[model samples]
Target: MGMTEKQLKSSNKPDKEMPLVQYENVTKKFGDVEVLKGLDLEIKQGEKVALIGPSGSGKTTIIRMLMTLEKPSGGVISLNGEPLWHKKIGDKLVPADEKHLRKLRSDIGMVFQHFNLFPHMTILRNVTEAPIHVLGLSKEEANERAVDMLNKVGLGDKLDAYPEQLSGGQKQRVAIARAVVMHPKVMLFDEVTSALDPELVGEVLQVIRDLAKETDMAMILVTHEMDFARDIADRVVFLHNGQIEEEGHPEDIFETPESERLQGFLSRFLNT
Candidate 1:
């Protein structure tokens, strides 16, 4: 989607009254282990927020629920002000069926810690597969979209390369290109750099930064890159024990954390 002047301007100042994504008192559990506890968060169109904390802090769970990869044990998740996991029938909100879930999942894109590419497919085919099958785009249209996105992510030269032939960073960039080609309204990054070598992280992050600037896509990153988070996120949230310990503007959260939990987390996370 080519951005007109108005669309570009909208990314800079997203409206707040109607949130594009909302999680109200959300909870999740595996057996008796609770992963998310009464979580509440709101994200607006074109906004970028980073979630940071120690291992098992519920950051990934939040996005997984939104992506419809995992259902919440309780509470409601809404996308564009409509219930995500349930549908309204008359006056009651009922559990959503497969059709509802599949349609909602199409509106969001997610990149996991691993590249998750198909070893059997070429780079260009990898990027084009979802659009052709899921979105029902014509083969020519999907190929056109894939080629343009591959060029943007600096993988145009490697179109015929297989996943096993590419470096880790290149694979992740392909993953980004694949997700972005679909024009998702929301993008989820779950520790995208965690599986990469130190030297490879910057290139992937740079691609994300460019996307953040170019599109009005709302982004939520579960990341450990303190500097990257500071530079990219409009807001930073610190989570602990499945709850938000504290949250604020990146500067406030990083520079002068008011809560002991966040302060300790930063000190330990950054120094390690």
Candidate 2:
């Protein structure tokens, strides 16, 4: 299905009603180079947005910012209508203190391009460790939750295996299980399947597809997998040179691109 008229019109502005995530006039700069420029985007509750573009188009930066791994140089980012990287103190807004930032960021989870697993920990331990320590769950409780998540990701049988014993695909599945055990309100995926072998990519994608089908978490995917993006995303955002150049339903963006830049970008993949 396509975006409603209201959603399309509000694409450049924050929905006053509060989306699950909102970026208003956000900019990011490093030294003299700007990576994102006045970018405004919103993801509604349960919506899945796929960001696609050429390298350095700032797609990954958006997810990194949402994950609180990077901060915007300008503009305000809000999650659930609350400030994310900044806080309002009386009449002025200031950078959020570490404690405030952590509280706000706890609602979000991210899985990266690499399978950043702890080699020394077993799959079960790797998945349970965060919840046991960060969320204050008891070890038994964490392990139970971890087992269920691993089962969902098709890794239940590998719980006792260390990261080094698993294949790259299996490692990524464990990573997904680890993130899901947090029960995040929003999930950020950065080129999640990019590092897998052609045969192994499907297993990882299937786990993500299951999440999209079974959960209500707002998902933002930064990926080069055009076909997967078309199949899984509710909306496709084509970013160009640090701005959202075009966005629409996957069918519209992939089959009937309205911008030459987007058409050119897709042509590279379509022709292959």
TM per model? 0.93, 0.94
Provide the RMSD of all predictions against the true structure, rounded to 1 decimal: 6.0, 3.3
Per-residue lDDT tens digits for candidate 2, residues 1-272, read: 23344357536545456688889889999889999998888888888999999999999999999889998999988999888999989978899999998898889999989989998999999999999999999999999999999998888999889999999899999998899899999999999988999899999998999899999998999999998999999999999999888888899898889889999999999899
Candidate 1 residue pairs in backbone clash? none
The segments of candidate 1 whose C-alpha lies over 4 angstroms from its true place after superposition are: 1-16
Query: Model 1: how far is 177 from its true place, Å?
Result: 0.6
lDDT of 1 at 88: 89
Q: Model 2: residues >4 Å from true position, as ranges?
A: 1-7, 10-16
lDDT of candidates 1 onward, in order: 0.90, 0.90
Model 2 accuracy (lDDT, Cα): 0.90
